[model samples]
Target: MHIKNKLSVAIILALTLGLAGCQSAYYKTMESFGYHKRDILVSNVEKARESQEEASEQFKSALDKFSALTGFHGGDLEDTYERLNDEYESSEAAAADVRKRIDAVAEVGNDLFDEWKTELSQYTSSKLRNDSRVKLSKTKSKFKKMLSAMRKAEKKIAPVLNVFHDQVLYLKHNLNAQAIASLKSELSNLETDIGKLIAEMQRSIDEANAFIKDLKKQ
Candidate 1:
């Protein structure tokens, strides 16, 4: 197969074989193949950031659709439902991708820090060892904060998704102007929740960007 396809297959297999559960063996294998923990950590963080960006857009699109639906005088309700449902699915997938990437980043980060600490113990020079230890501490602190922000953002997703799910299902049952009017009544609360979700997502995205920049500079 093509090189890109080969790489895609490899990644799918890696994830399927329990990237987290077998992380020790997985890391060893990747390292033997010349991919180190640092590379994985950076890549995963980028993936998480991308996912967050997509999720943000998908959510905003869904909100826009809802707003438009409220003002909608007439339209094919089935078509609108399908569009919103598609947006919800896309958002759900994006959220899942972000979580996966964050977990991968965390796993590699833990391994990298453990190895750094172990190597520090091996260093005989007090000044050099102390400096390395200090840098490691700072990196770990930043990573912890980033992970916390990411998890907080992730937590916000489920509630928003639940709201979307309810709206979608309700629409499926009552796909008419009357249903639209009923949902219009709910638009305010929905918008409020989505606004909160978007804010959390933006915060996490900013943290991810900073974290990625720091890692690159290291």
Candidate 2:
């Protein structure tokens, strides 16, 4: 891998590792609380907030790149800018959720982290263990390559978003069934891809937790 790619992988891995620890912290908190199968959603909300912040930075940084590579200022792309704004709003909502969850957890106790983890472990599905077992088998190099491939989709985001903006502008002046259909198709694909990534990450998280549980059993 090139140095730039290595750097990117390292950034992503560091972020991913931080996230795993955050998840572990939440699990531990829940275990200490001794709450069985309760929705300790604050961790996920925090993760979402972190994701949004990172994405916002990336989006802003990509603006310069977008202009240089595609001759497009993100400002000129109103629809795309709106999309970014929407993400910001979503992040805020997620942060709110995190606060609410924090309050709920605090009401229980300050040192309930370990109980929370134990409680969560009781309900974790065996499927998660199986899934994690498979993914965990890979060497770091292969895993990094896979992560890079997944991240490649994000590289096209600026140009793709710019095109979406242009299409919205195009629709304003010239409405056609074919164009509308095409727009929906592209948007649907984007939604599906994003959904898949989120699901995959959740599964990965579950797998990691399952591994932790296995360690505790020993």
Candidate 3:
């Protein structure tokens, strides 16, 4: 077999054997098979963006569903709670997925930096090495800022989730006209929370886009 194909098989085996711990090994194997860190970094950034987009949509859907619940009337109280609960659960999962994607991006980025630093030691020309080091330092700084923005948005989801959980649980116990009436006053707060959540999400998305553009040059 060709060397690249052998490395690919090894990567598959490593993944099958050690899914979580195989990151460094996975990167090395892929590098050996001719895939560079910059390529992986781009792919990871795209994944993070996709995940954030999905999370944004899911949260929006949850907001819509909660709005519908406020308008809810006399039919299938249990069924309504079930649907809203499902949306809440789905939103939670989407948020988790966003975090996971961001972590993956950071992992590949760190791997790239470590490799870049080591490779700098091998450079015969101090000028080129120093130039490369400066670029790496700049990239790391940008990444730190972008990652902070992403995590800040991620933290916004928790409070919104808490609100949803409270409403869902309230509805579960008091699935009556009175419970529905009480929720009317809560609508304003819900709307505000949802608005804030969406705004934060948009900010995170913007950061992700800016960072992706900034680093793709590498």
> Which numbered prediction scores highest in lDDT against the true structure?
1
Q: List, residue by residue over 56-128, the lDDT tens digit for candidate 3.
A: 8888888888788778757999999899889989988998898888887887788788888889999999999
TM-score of candidate 1 against the unseen true structure: 0.87
Model 3 residue 89 CA deviation (Å) reads: 1.2
Candidate 1 yields a Cα-based lDDT of 0.84
Clashing pairs in 1: none
lDDT of each: 0.84, 0.42, 0.82
Clashes of each: 0, 16, 0
Ranking by TM-score: 3, 1, 2
lDDT against true structure, model 2 = 0.42
Q: Model 1, stretches more than 4 Å misplaced?
A: 1-20
Name the Cα RMSD for model 3. Answer: 2.7
Candidate 2 lDDT by residue in tens digits, 61-117: 433332332333234444544453454344345434434433433332222333443
The CA root-mean-square deviation of candidate 1, after full C-alpha superposition on the true structure, stands at 2.8
- Per lDDT, what order, best first? 1, 3, 2
lDDT of 3: 0.82
